[model samples]
Target: MAVATGLKQEQVVAAAASDNALERLHALLTEDLRQVNALIISRMESPVPLIPQLAGYLIASGGKRLRPLLTLAAARLFGYQGDAHLLIATAVEFIHTATLLHDDVVDESDLRRGRESANSVWGNQASVLVGDFLFSRSFELMVETHSLEVLRILSRASAVIAEGEVLQLITSNDTATVEADYLRVIEGKTAELFAAACEVGAVIAGCDKQACAAMRDYGMALGMAFQIVDDVLDYSAVQAQLGKTVGDDFRAGKITMPILIAIAKGNEEERAFWNRTLERQEQEEGDLDHAIALLRQHDALDGAMDRAREWGERAIAALEHAPESVLKQALADVIAFCIERDY
Candidate 1:
């Protein structure tokens, strides 16, 4: 089910995007990630058995756990020498998992991380309530850290993520959605948590404001790059590796950057097609192919990747402000994984 829109995963990851970045990072952070996993499992437990069952369903499903890894890696970069990084990393993961539950409910999505989404299995109400439980559990972890700053950073990120989700809801199915609007939505939804994840790592390490800012910048840039690449992959990647089926965005009428660029650059006939498929919700057979054709004709997906690359470069540059360490270099490698994964 790879979108045969004429762009293959091989074509997309041809040059800049390297899979080794994640592998290297994983190897570098193996022990710390193991601890984070144990913390995640232990914290997911609740008196109510359903909570752990539903949470465990998705938790056991393989996600790379990249955000928590970022937290641990950032803390390690600053020579943090305590167990707090482990706790904070687990908390960051809980926040992310909560968002995923809510997002699947919002999207009415049946699939997640290449399997049945939690919402699909447990019903939306269960999925949402469990998500809330995870969020609450995360705050408990934050309280255990006893750092007001860490709590403040994560709480703000949670609020921002809510705003982003709300904004995306408002804009969904609107072909008129603009690039600025799309970027803003992703900033709130994707990048804010990433920034917080890395920032909290630095905070726990007692890094100064400058080092904290550097980690934030790195995370933000990587998040932006990661999201844009994901959007492109919706139309250009192997469906097996895409975490969701191809053309899910288009079918949902959720206007993404590729669609926006095409709308801006396409001719009148092409515009009508977008309006019918997206705005009018009048999709017909062959629409995915046609959408892909328009995107390819306009080179919109390629253009979107270029923007992702620019952000990746910024992510790499942000690392320079932090003191050099193997962890820092691993974070840099994450930038490559963000940008160049299956184009």
Candidate 2:
């Protein structure tokens, strides 16, 4: 699959190697996407060389630009005209990138998109400060939109994303975390921006409240499914295919849904194993293999994927009231793409 713009062919192949619907969506929006990329490049410029260097490096890291793609797709689906969507799209991208930088620093992650992370290449301090710059730039882009709701929506998302990261920090190293707590973490860290991006697409399109609600619900649900699958992939995917080290979450003691499921169904010995590895963070080599085995034995991975499928279904249902178009179908296909990620 030649995924969206801004991805290398190899990365695309590794990810959605044969997803035709995703490719069609990318092809349909090619011209508008070109404009979005131009704005992103221009806005990233800074007098400070390190800021641009680090920012540009991560920005080009070629993960799915899914958030911005959703913003653009949503706007067009609602018949948005004018170039305002371009600015909003770029702002969404900046916000997402800033969070990735902050996340890598906090996670002490060495790899991103199958390459050395910015925090690894530059220092943590540099990565953190530069993330701050990009975050500030996001607000500047939002302010240019001149829509209070747009500002309100994205500003709130930015705040919630920070809170989510903090919440994940609080939940780390604790296997006792429940499913609801895990859901809250993903909502704040991952889904809030996704919801805002799509909701703002309606804002720019001048759509009514009903359409806006539909867009927000669609994005939130899709984002929820996306993050669940992402956590599952951390434990199940090839590290190179995923563009990050597999078991990173396990090493960091992050309490995700799979672990929660396994804990719910695991025997006493399995529970102790989880507590030692995830709760106490007393992990050693071969611990990850054992953890994977436990998850499989308990069928936690299947349960997690089932939960993801439910959310993906909810996302499609949310879009039912929207008008029919190729864009609408493409957006639906995007939900399928999110749920079906194997890379």
Model 2 per-residue lDDT tens digits across residues 112-214: 8888999999989999999999899999998998899999999999999999999999999888899999999999999999999999998899999999999
Residue-by-residue lDDT tens digits, candidate 1, 1-343 = 2211212344333312434777666666667788899999999988999999999998888888999988987887787878898889999999999999999999999989778899888999999999999999999999999999999999999999999999999899888888899999999999999999999999999999999998999899989999999999999856646455789899999988888889999989888899999988898899999899889999999999999999999888888877655556667777877787773
Measured with C-alpha atoms, the lDDT of residue 193 in candidate 1 is 91
Off by over 4 Å in 1: 1-19, 240-244
Cα misplacement distance, residue 258 of candidate 2 (Å): 0.8
Error of model 1, residue 263, in angstroms: 0.7
State the local distance difference test value for candidate 2: 0.87
Q: Estimate each model's TM-score.
A: 0.92, 0.93
lDDT of 1 at 162: 100
| CA RMSD (A), model 2 | 4.6
